[model samples]
Target: MFTKKILIDLDGVLNEYGKDKFNENYIPEIKIGAYEFIEKLSKQAELYLFTSRNLMLATKWLINNNLDKFFKDVTNTKLSSYLYIDDRCICFKGDYCNLFDEIEEFKPWYRK
Candidate 1:
């Protein structure tokens, strides 16, 4: 059996980020349905917590929220994965020709 590797971001994907003022040691509430999402995904793929936040704090947050079991690791380095579920990302088509234009025109769905 083969499970697809997935890297899921923490801040805006799993956590209700920007809902409260930033705190280094505190992770805000989990996003609605985040647990359910992870639970369902965990059953189908390998999950990794890919974030720039502090690993210790993130681990504590996961433990507190009872979500520690779903993830294999918390990492800042990009690892091998089939998919990456992040709030702020653009899907690339391996064409560098339009990369600059794409970046220049990209907006994270918040401006609209």
Candidate 2:
């Protein structure tokens, strides 16, 4: 079996960005169940975290939450990756007409 490489985003996917009003702290507010979900996925395939945030900030957030171990690498805007996971993306498996169906069936945290 060929395991696919997955790249995940930080600001919205794993961490909630701008959650607190006008708060400029470097700290990241982690999404619910994000750490465990990433850890499980890491065991199945290659995992990469791609974020536009400052490297030091992103690194510190991951390290503080103990989620750093799950990622094979952490990238800022300077890197390239495959199969990016970001909230801003509209992803689907097949034809456009089937997009809604695919999304309805898609569950990143669980597989059958």
Candidate 3:
């Protein structure tokens, strides 16, 4: 019944992800404000947790954090959605200019 589908990244976006360590069995604690943010967003759109980690692991993380109810699914693939909320992305402004500089200068919020 949602009018929009939002794909939200699990690590840096929703959880503490300052480290590059990759483990299928481990996911960090939920980021501050993430629970409230997701709760609020869920009222406006359907949310999907997008991650490179195992879907079952991600789902379990959500459940552990009591956040599973806000998401429609956990997916590794980028599904069709109204917006993709990722911390590792740069919004393209329809110009190739400054793209390289932006890429080189880019740092996820956690890094800054």
Candidate 4:
């Protein structure tokens, strides 16, 4: 049993996602450093693959990339986790003042 649970996003976080149009049935190749990153992170916490895509497809992608061993499971729902690692998230600093602007200006790292 792991002490911490981390939710990791699949698309932009693990794979080269922004270059191609969205396709539910397809997952792009793993991103550079992704395998090593996951391998390292898995040692620290219970990692779960979090995605809106089909779980079966995501699992297949993980298997093809030989990354399935690092993850506990693939889930679409936001489970209870210590942290969420995603390319499209904006950290909330307990202030709503700048949130709207941040949302308006926000772009994933790949797009920027």
RMSD of each predicted structure: 1.9, 6.1, 1.5, 1.1
- Residue pairs clashing in model 1 are none
lDDT of 2: 0.74
What TM-score would candidate 4 get against the native?
0.96
Q: Which residue pairs does candidate 4 place in steric collision?
A: none
- State model 3's lDDT: 0.92
> Which regions in candidate 1 have their CA more than 4 angstroms from the true location?
109-112
User: Model 3, residue 72: displacement in angstroms?
Assistant: 0.8
- Tens digits of per-residue lDDT for model 2, 8-106: 888767875556553445655788899889989899878877877677777888888899898877886534445778765566556699777767776
Compute the lDDT of residue 44 as modeled in candidate 1: 92
- TM-score (all chains, Cα) for each model: 0.85, 0.68, 0.93, 0.96
Q: Over the stretch 5-66, how does candidate 4's per-residue lDDT look in tens digits? A: 99999999999999999887899999999999999999999999999999999999999999
Best candidate according to TM-score: 4
Candidate 4 versus truth, CA RMSD in Å, comes to: 1.1
Clashes (N, CA, C under 3 Å) per candidate: 0, 0, 0, 0
Query: Residue 57 of model 1: what lDDT?
Result: 88
Candidate 3: which stretches are off by over 4 Å?
A: 19-22
The candidate 4 region of ten consecutive residues with least summed lDDT is 1-10
Worst 10 residues of 3 by lDDT: 16-25
Sorted on TM-score, best first, the list reads 4, 3, 1, 2
lDDT at residue 10 of model 4 (Cα atoms): 90
- What lDDT would each prediction earn against the true structure? 0.87, 0.74, 0.92, 0.95
